[model samples]
Target: MNKQAQAVVMLLFGGAIVRASLTDMYLRYVKESLRPFLIAAGLVLIAAAVMTLVHEVLRPKERAEEHDHGHDHGDGKPHREPWVAWLLILPVLGLLLVAPPALGSYAAGQSGTALSSQQISDYPPLPPGDPAKISVLDYASRAVFDKGVSLGDRTVRLTGFIASGPNGEPILARIILSCCAADGRPIKLGMSGNAPAGLANDSWVEVIGRYTDRTITDPVNEETIPYIEVETWTQIDPPKQQYE
Candidate 1:
């Protein structure tokens, strides 16, 4: 592509990145801690594009003529940019219009929890609260690997979307990202003891429960999933950050 065309594309892409980072939209694709770095990268791209554009406009006519002649063939048509260069605008348009929705139950169902065989060290007891809020990943890890010993008798609140089990039974689940959505996987917890019934998949909810000894086997991966003896549950809006 010509330098002028390249600079315009760069400016659009960089502006999209900066615009996304300025709001919570970026959290849908990456971790909250990555916001600053994303903003910095966007700024760098914008600076580079601006510099290229300035340099192109200020070039002496003699130098421009000489450079063009050096590479120009005896063709009748003007040079055209590569078709692939236009594809870069797709993401820019998407970013400007609407960010993609966060991963949901379908992704959770396709994924299997590896924490069943994992050896998580004893986590400290939950802090004070009748139903102390806990992350779905943390709760699942403690229940499966640590035998729920750290959870004690305290009830904890877990928030996640509903995912169906082998028998079409409802279960609580959340996606866990190692770095970004590309490496994300779901951690699951089976619901027992007065578990909510007839809830649709991906209906975000806050489940109140304590760890239980009961376990369920995941048919897809043949991994064991731990249970929570649910005291109660209530439907709610999805959280601002969907992944753990």
Candidate 2:
């Protein structure tokens, strides 16, 4: 490519690096899986820029004798080695060696659906004890569509972080998000039985519970809302991302 075209490519590559480094969204969604490839692409772009610079600097002058022999200026550029392009491989290799983790606690305070409460009356009740275990997302989504009537007295297990409610009580909560943690809304479930066992905020837990659809007035907001009443709760390790 010509100097101008090479320069534009270099600019784009630099812009991508800046963008990836500045925003967590791209790292959360786009760069996680393709980290190695992105690193490789960055290195390649850097190499291209260096090679273009070298070629521009070392370009040889045309010979007068060659012109007499019917030789052309050949686009006024020297033949460049494609192997020099491999210099781009360095960044990618580094990324491949050290892929970063996904978005984490740093985004806990962001505003998003991951932390929002859902309408409890919308979900079907849990069916009587069955072997097929369901996920918290299924329960939450169902709660959004229909009240937990279909879950009737069935024991459902939910796993998530132990976030504090408006009150001093330890609530088993999980952040449900529309996109990344930035949009996460907190959903708190009321644990029944004995008070949560040695539970602490941000700790992970698996709670087996019967879904009770009842509205409890929020002391902070003074608004009555629905919540899942827990039957059993067990503490466990916190997952990488509290919200998926």
Candidate 3:
């Protein structure tokens, strides 16, 4: 596309990045250090726009001989370029400036709201009172499907936000998904022991604890509550995105 169109697209994306960063949504979905890339890209687009403007103003008028080829479209007609060509810069600028945040309660109750219920027989058992090293997706998947069976009786640590559930008690929660937030599934964690005082919904926390299999009968279905008997609860910043 023409430089002017490209510049406009870049500006649009730059605005989006600014909005996302200011709202902390970028941190939720993207790494913090990458924000500068957006600003740089936007500046480049602005520069390109200035260059295009200068070139249009400074170019000498074409002589009549330039049209000797008998072209139906004369040079006097303004050049037109597709707008889509300029759109390419948007994603790059958006990522560099402010990546989108992880899905939160806004997507908690949609269809495909839980992880696959496959038997996790291969997962190694956790040793009591040890810090568990697992991906966020694996943790969420285990919580959703395996629940009691997956956790069994073991001490582990998990980090995520306190998401709202149907009931009033704030359930320790995390998201698991096959793709983006639109496909995210919510996994509720059972919190035990002394939870940190003044824990609010959406507050980020790390819980080091053990698991107990408790059967919870939901109105929709019978599910197991894989309870985490909290050994210690520490507040922390939430990740930018729910899924890696």
Candidate 4:
């Protein structure tokens, strides 16, 4: 690849980043807090490409003079980049053509729910509502550490995708992201009672349930994840934001 091709590839890559961020598609890969940084990075890439092209076009005479004077570092060869560097544009092309969906049940089933003391105390008080809406992370923390004190005797609603447990039981699960999909981890709650009709892996669903005393211990590591006594469930389309 030459300088011009490299610049063009940068421009395309930058444009794709900016577009994804602006359109909220970046949520699939990164947290909302990273929107500004992603946009800034895209703009910097675009500016660098534009400046490089401008300099080349505006200083044609200087380049010609350098060439005539054999200013090629006296190596008898002009600058050249390795051909493999052109592969950088493959990501941009894939993003443009496919626009892959966010991580799903397959990833959730592969990992155990991670718990920490600091995270257990970080959640806000349970909000006011009939079926108090709460995140999977918050639920996991309270259920494991506090023993569902805040959630006692109250119906709670959780929205997430269905993941198959090791024994093929349907579990309500969501990916918790600190920064991006690369670092995302799954937190899950086991559902009791009948699963909603047509329940399948990766299917988004809203579960109305209460925390149960039953705790599920992972067979591999013995980490305890809580269970919920489900009252009812409704299948729904995947939300615009897929991560917690």
The lDDT ranking, best first, is 1, 4, 3, 2
Q: Write the per-residue lDDT of candidate 2 for residues 2-57, one digit (tens) a residue.
A: 46345555845654654564444345445245556656666677777777767665
* RMSD of each candidate relative to the true structure: 2.5, 10.4, 7.3, 2.8
User: How accurate locally, in lDDT, is each candidate?
Assistant: 0.84, 0.53, 0.57, 0.81
Q: How accurate is candidate 3 locally (lDDT)?
A: 0.57
For TM-score, the strongest prediction is: 1
Candidate 3: tens digits of C-alpha lDDT, residues 109-194? 33323533555535556544457755544554555555546665555677777755445555566776544345466666556576
Residue by residue across 108-138, what tens digits does model 4's lDDT show? 8788776654553444568998899988877
What is candidate 1's lDDT per residue for 34-65, written digit by digit as tens? 99999999999999999999998899877566
lDDT of 3 at 9: 61
List ranges where model 4 is wrong by over 4 Å. Answer: 61-80, 117-125
- Backbone clash pairs for candidate 3 read 27-240, 28-101, 28-102, 28-240, 28-241, 29-101, 29-240, 38-96, 38-97
State every prediction's TM-score relative to the real structure. 0.90, 0.51, 0.56, 0.89
TM-score of 3: 0.56
